[model samples]
Target: MYDTLKDTYQLFEEIGRGRFGTILRAFCPVSAESVAVKIIDKSLLTDETDRACLEKEPKIMTLLSPHPNILKIHNVFETEDSMAMVLELCEPETLYDKIAHRPLPEPEAAGLMKQLLGAIAHCHRMGVVHRDLKPENVLFDSRNNLKLADFGSAEWSGEGGSMEGVVGTPYYVAPEVLMGRLYNEKVDVWSAGVMLYIMLGGIPPFYGETATEIFEAVLRGNLRFPPKVFRGVSPAAKDLLRKMMCRDVSRRLSAEQALRHPWILSGGEANPMD
Candidate 1:
C-alpha cells in the first residue's frame, strides 16, 4: 500500500534512529514541504510484538490527535516489504537537550510544564495513554512550542481502563508499574513528576546503579529536597511536585487537576504565558 512512499518521499538527512526503525527528514515532492518519516523494514514487523505495538499507532493518532502539543501524523501505510509513517517535522531536539545542560528560568519552566500537562490532559480525555513520558520523548518545534512525540509505546484504554504492562523508562516508571500491578494514565503523571524533579534538581528523585536497584528505590517512594538543591524553587512548586509524584496512584493529581495547580495557574500576572 505504501510502495509509493519510496517514490514520494526523498530522504534528505537522518534525524534519529531507534530500536525498530530509522527516522529521516524527507521531502515529498508532491507536497513541496519537509516531513519526518519512519521507515520500518519488513523483517522487524514479522515479529508479532513489534507489529502489534506499531499497528495501532496510525489509528490512535487519528483518534486522539490535533492537540497543539501532541505530535500529529500526516499519513501511514505499509507495502509488501515495509511500513512508513509520515509525520510533522518537529525540531531535531528534545526537552532533555534543553534542560540537561541547565534548568530553564523557573517561570518559563512552569509555562512549559503547563503545555506538557495540557497535551497529556488531551490524551487522557480521549482515553489514550502515553505509556512512556520522559524528556527524551518530548519535542520542541522551531517556535520553541512543545510537542509530545514518540507514541510507539502508547496504548488505547478501553472500557475496562486499567492495564498491566511493565513499560516506560526505569527512572520515570510509576510505583504501580514497578510493582507489576494494574495501571492507568496516572503512570504518565508520575513519569512527568520524575521529569519535573530532574528539571529542577538536575537529578532524578530516585537513582541507582542498576535498573533493579532503581526499581527498588522508586518503590520506596522516598523524595528529598535538600535546601541547596531546591533553595530557589518555590513552595508551591514543591507542593505540586509532591502531589504529582505521590506514590499512591489514587492520591496523585490527575492531569487536569495538575494543570490547575497554583504553580501553573498562579505563576504571576506579569507572566506572558498566562
Candidate 2:
C-alpha cells in the first residue's frame, strides 16, 4: 500500500513514531505543499473496533475544520494494506518538549495558555471534549501559537454519547476519571491545570517511579508548590490552579471561568521576573 503512494509523496525523514504509527515529513508534489503523513500499520487494525475508530478520525477532523489552534487534516486515504492521514506540519516542538528544556516565562506562559484555553473553549462550544489535553498533544506553530493535536481520544458530546473508556495520559487524567466516575468537560479543565503547573514549575505536581504510584499520588490530591523553583508564581495564579485542579470535578473551574480568572484577565500581564 505505502509502496504505491510512496512515489506520490516525497518522504524526507521520520519525524515521530508512536504505538500506532510513524509520521514522516513529506511533500505533495501535485499541490506543491508539505504535510506530515502518518502511516498506520494494517496489522494494528486487528479488530472491528479499531477499524471503526481509525475510520472515525477523518470524520472528526472534518467536523473540526477551520479552528485556528487545531491541526488541520488535509486528506485521508487507505491502500489495500495501510491507512494514511495528511496533516498540517507544525514546526519546532511540542509544549512538553519545550518545558523539558526550561520553565516558560510567566507572560509567555500566560499568552500560550490563553491560546490553549481558547482552543479548548472552542472545542467545548462545538460539543467536542478533547479527552487528552496534555503538553505532548499541544504543538507549537512557527509563531509559537498553540495548536491542539492528536484527537484520537476526543469524543463528540452533543449526540448524547458519553465516554466511558479510560483514556488520557496518566499524569494529566482527572481524579474523577481515574475513579471511574462519569464526567464531562470539566475533565479537560483538570488536564489544562496540570499543563499550567508544568509551565510554571517545569514539572508536574505529581510524579512517581511507576504509573501506579503516580495514580496513587493523584488520588491523594497532594499538590505541592515548589516556591523556590516557581519563584514568581503569583497568588492569583496559585488560586486559579487550586480551583482548576480541585479533586471534586463539580468544583473544578469551567473553561470560561478559568479564562476569566484574575490571573489570566488581570490588568497587568504576568511577569516571570517578579
Judged by lDDT, which candidate is best? Answer: 1
Per-residue accuracy of model 2 over 94-161 as CA lDDT, tens digit each: 88888897877767777777888888888788788889899889997777778998877787775553
> Which residue runs of candidate 2 sit more than 4 Å off their true CA positions?
1-8, 46-49, 158-161, 267-274
Write candidate 1's Cα lDDT for 31-84 as tens digits.
898899987886766567668788877888777678889888888878767788
User: Which clashing pairs does model 1 show?
Assistant: none
| Candidate 1, superposed: residue stretches over 4 Å from native | 1-3, 45-47, 268-274
TM-score result, candidate 1: 0.93
Each model's lDDT: 0.84, 0.81
Candidate 2 TM-score, true structure as reference: 0.90
Write down the worst ten-residue block by lDDT for model 2. 265-274
After superposing all C-alphas onto the true structure, candidate 2 shows an RMSD in angstroms of: 2.8
Candidate with top TM-score is 1
